[model samples]
Target: MDIGYILSGFAVGFLVGITGVGGGSLMTPLLVFLFGFKPIVAVGTDLLFAALTKTGGVWVHHGKHKSVDWKVVGLMATGSLPVSAVTIYIIKHLMSVGKEITGLITFALGIALILTACALLVRSLLLRKHEREVESSSISTGRFQGTTQIALTIATGAILGALVTLSSVGAGALGTIAILLLYPKMSTLKVVGTDLAHAIPLTAIAGIGHWSLGHVDFGLLGSLLIGSLPGIWIGSHLSARIPEKILRPILATLLLLIGLKFVLA
Candidate 1:
């Protein structure tokens, strides 16, 4: 019943709702730096938190039906799932070697954060460029190219699987940017939905692996959920009124600062 943890979750959830980034990127750092949790514990907790939170999102997206691209999700899962399994085995093996894993986790988290910041900053620009590309390209059965798009999607998913398994980051922000770049003709909302749909399984596998390694703290997870569920709901309701152009750069800057701090630490 730590009020501070609950409040932090609320804030993170609100920001995630508006920005569509920061779930794993910000939450793990907050737990590690502010709450003084171990890097592994923070990452493990956030992975499950991400999985559960995004489940609700997937439901919403599926309800809309048009927002989610199941083909994309399938391709991503195909690549990501196997990599996630291998990463879990590697991390468990690393853990058996003792305290060395902590430093590795910290290093990975910092690198992922820097990448997430850059992804956020460039996300809008990518979207605009994508729009232009879409206008220039001819309509094609309302679908992307067959083999090339699938290959890129799987490759992106493999990257996400490895990074998220290591640091519990990249499934959201980095995933968004990669998809937008690979499938520039996709609608923004569809890209988000597909990414989210893929994240549930990816995070759940990683989370469960961490749990088996005794890194997850269920009490902390529950407290975070208590605050974040309502916060995301409220933020999404209010999102239309906010100016995204102003918000994204600021968020990116904050992520850059936090990432730099972790790297320096």
Candidate 2:
């Protein structure tokens, strides 16, 4: 029943609704810096939070647009799921060795936040560049094919799997960017849908793994969900009125500063 945590979740959800940024990029840091939660707990809680919140998006994408590419999702899952399990095993071993793992988690979280910030800043530019390339090349209907593209897509998923498991960030924004780059011909809707589809399982498994390690805080997770669900609904309704061009840079800058703080700490 912490009102502060509820409000924090609302704010993060509101921003995410408008910007389409992932909650982990915002919530994990908030839990650590604002609430003084351990990095491992914050990350674990946020992973389940992310998985639950994003579940709605998957159904929306599937029912309305059918934009999700199952093949790509399957390919990514092939790489991500095994790595996620392996990451959990490694973390458990580290903990058993009486090694300090919070520092590692904090470092990974910081790095992920910085990467997400850069992704947000450059997303529009990258899309524009992609459009230009498409126009110049007259390429239409870009789809994933060939052994190299398949390998790269799987590799991207593996990287994201490890990154998300460690930091509870990256499965959203970073995943989208990697998929967009790999499948340049995909529509934005498809890219988002595919990424989100992949993220559900990734976050769920990672969250469960963290829960098994006793890193997740259910009370905190409940408080966050209480506010975030409504906040996301309201924010999505209001998103059309916001100027994304102005908002993204400011958010990116905020993330950059926060990332530096965590990295330095």
Candidate 3:
């Protein structure tokens, strides 16, 4: 029922619908800096918020565009799901032993935000470089690289799993950039779809784990969803009309500044 929370959610959701990033990267920081929530609670609440908001995106991409690459999703999930569970277990154990982890979580969130900003800034350059590398490779080398890329994808998933569970900030911009770097041949649509598809279960599991640790704020979650759902719907419809070249750099700059504040605070 807090209008400020609702407005913040709508803003984040609108940006996410347009750029396919910013859910956790923006929301977690807002919760911490603006609303004065603890880092753990902010991350935990944002995880479920991200999961629910992105479900509609998966449906649109899979049903209408058929852009989801299930094989890649399965491979990524193979690594991410287990690691996510283990991360939750470790955090739970630490908290049970009376460890004070608020500062740790804040630092982790700051690092993740910084990485996400860097990923956003370099996304196009990374893709172009990947394409050049692909073009220069020999056929035999290509086959070997395929096998390697699969392993790399799973490894990337494991990294995301740990990062997302700890901070709720890596599964959007960071995930998309990692997918593009690994699968340079994939179309943007496929990369977005696959990333979103993988994010659903990862966030769900992580959110549930945080819930068990009493980190989630259901009231905040509900308020966010109320405005975000509509915001996403509107923003998606307008995305194609927007110039991403203009938007991304601005968004990236904002994330970078917020990240630095968290890290230095």
Candidate 4:
């Protein structure tokens, strides 16, 4: 593994563990803006990275007996998976025909980044309103059987699938926030756990699609993974000790700047 890639993996992994917002939001952008990866390649690689990294989280949560609302995850996947498949098919077709899609990918990435920044800011606001939850960890769920809510949940999943496939910048903070808005009564621990669980299949499917399209770089993926494992462990431990009041704003600002650079470039 390249030392630089390992370092990047560790940094991004730790941030994701600590802030719950870095897997795609930070890593994809870093690949594009910092490491000069093509937008499509960066997104594709990061999608796999997210899948691999979060798989471990799922195991840990299960081992700890943390609650995961399988019904909700199923509902969301019903919408996300099919849409993701179609999106990748379209992308692969375009690529096969030598279509000029860079503009499309770049534009999508830029928009996704901006949206991620907004989501991060919104999470901070939500946490501020619920002061006691600022340091709370884990995710759990409550009942929501309303037809409207179910439809909305599926719709959210569809949107998430499309966005993540195109930009690799959702299913992390964005998905969690969507879950929170949909089920405010659910346990925060469940919400996060569910989100994390859903992300793995969602990203893994999308990553496989990208791989078929030849957008994934396995060498780079290996390097990033090497560092991310340790980074995430460290970040999870450091989270309770760190002040959100300091970290949130800084991360938000960084996202905003990077997003603007992409869109306005």
Candidate 5:
């Protein structure tokens, strides 16, 4: 057993717990840059790692009634599932052409990571704005509804599916931002819940597809899981004691650095 890989996994899991971002954004890049794994293998292994880790989170959230928006989840799945299938087909074709698909995927992952970071930063700003607006005005007791919202949700889901399938990024922070933007009236907890619910199946399906294509490294994934499971538990237990003001900026800085590294590599 490679203790280094396990320790890396623990570090990534701790970040995920601290930020609520998926492991792929951090894990895939770490594998590629720090461990010198091929980009394709890093992405494939991280997808499986994300699917497994998020499945447990989804279950816990469901048990607590705090992690799902079934209708929104269904809509996202409807759009994302087909897009994911198409993305895998395209990746397989690129692989068949003997192209440097890993480089392309890495580049795409870097771009996606940067975009997710921006989305997170913007979301924080928007939430602050919304809170201020609410403080100045009476709160409305209405839910968002309209063709525009539905269409936007579907479009966001499609984009997430393609990005995630190609780079294993964008489905966590990016997805949540889409939800928050589309339905500002909804509680933040609900938005996160719905996003997680939708991401579980989407990542699982994509991960399985990558596995079938022989992209995933089972040993690496196992090693990651061995460390991440306990790390997540510990992080979650300690989360409330930590201050978000410090965490967000640090996470954003990490994402920015990793994104730049991947893009410039």
Candidate 6:
């Protein structure tokens, strides 16, 4: 048990729990761009880290009966699982070109980060708008059900699957936004819980695929997990104490800086 790695994991995990952002979105870029991890190794390790962290979230959500929308989860998994497999296959095959492949992966990751940032920005605005509308409305609504909504959800899932495999970005804030947009009638809490539930399996399949390709770094994964578990526990406990009005802006700023760094790197 490397104390340092454990601490780092704890920190990342805490952020994930507090913010409901996918660890991969933050952890992968942090590992590669800041910590000098190889791009593939960073991606692989982060996938596993994401899987491990989300596992706990899934369990808690399930135990409380608040972690899922089975229909939505099934739809997402239907599209994502195969896409993840295909994306991994492409990466593995492309790596035959060696260093060039790594460069490509890094570029993809950068683009994904930028996209994720944009998604987060859009989500914030939409949620604000939704909040305003709800306040003005005399009644609360139930889940959205329509052809357009279903189609959009499936499309969003497909996009997330592709992006997650390429850059490990879309599964967090991005996925949540898609859900919010497609199912505006649902409460925020339910959306977040359901999204996390779906992400667990989606990430697990993708992470295992990466592992099979010999891309994952077990030592790095171990370190991240050690740190993230406790970090998440503390973050979850403190979530109510923090003000979203303050936290949202800070998180948005962080995302902007990170996105810019990746683009520039």
256: Cα error in model 2, Å: 1.1
Residue 66's lDDT within candidate 4 is 66
Better of 3 and 6 by TM-score: 3
Residue 192 C-alpha lDDT in model 4: 76
lDDT-best of 1 and 5: 1
| Tens digits of lDDT, candidate 4, 1-265 | 6898899999998887788776888888888867898999998999998898888887776568465667778989999999999999999889879998778887787888788888888987875565223222212322355687788889999999999999898788889888878777656677778888999999999999999888999999999999999999999999999886787778888887887888887
Clash-forming residue pairs, model 2: none
lDDT of 4: 0.83
Over all chains combined, what TM-score does candidate 5 have? Answer: 0.91
Stretches off by above 4 angstroms in model 5 are 131-144
Query: What are the root-mean-square deviations of the candidates from the true structure over C-alphas?
Result: 2.8, 2.9, 3.4, 3.3, 3.5, 3.7
Q: Lowest-scoring 10 consecutive residues by lDDT in candidate 1?
A: 133-142
Q: What is the TM-score of each candidate against the true structure?
A: 0.92, 0.94, 0.92, 0.92, 0.91, 0.88
Q: Give me the candidate number with maximum lDDT.
A: 2
lDDT (C-alpha, whole model) for all candidates: 0.85, 0.88, 0.86, 0.83, 0.80, 0.73
- C-alpha lDDT of candidate 1 relative to the true structure: 0.85
Tell me how far the alpha carbon of residue 54 in candidate 4 is from the true structure, in angstroms, after superposition: 0.4
Better of 2 and 3 by lDDT: 2
Minimal lDDT window, size 10, model 3: 134-143
Candidates arranged by lDDT, highest first:
2, 3, 1, 4, 5, 6
* Candidate 4, pairs of clashing residues: 138-189, 139-188, 139-189, 139-190, 140-189, 140-190, 140-191
C-alpha lDDT of candidate 3 relative to the true structure: 0.86
**Model 6 deviation from the true structure expressed as Cα RMSD, one decimal place:** 3.7
TM-score quality measure for candidate 2: 0.94
Give the local distance difference test score of model 2: 0.88
Off by over 4 Å in 4: 130-145
Top candidate, metric TM-score: 2
**Candidate 2 C-alpha lDDT tens digits along 1-265:** 8999999999999988988885899899899888999999999999999999999999999899887888889989999999999999999999999999989998898999999999987786776676522221111333555787778888998999999999999998899898777878777777888899999999999999999999999999999999999889988888899998889899889888888888999
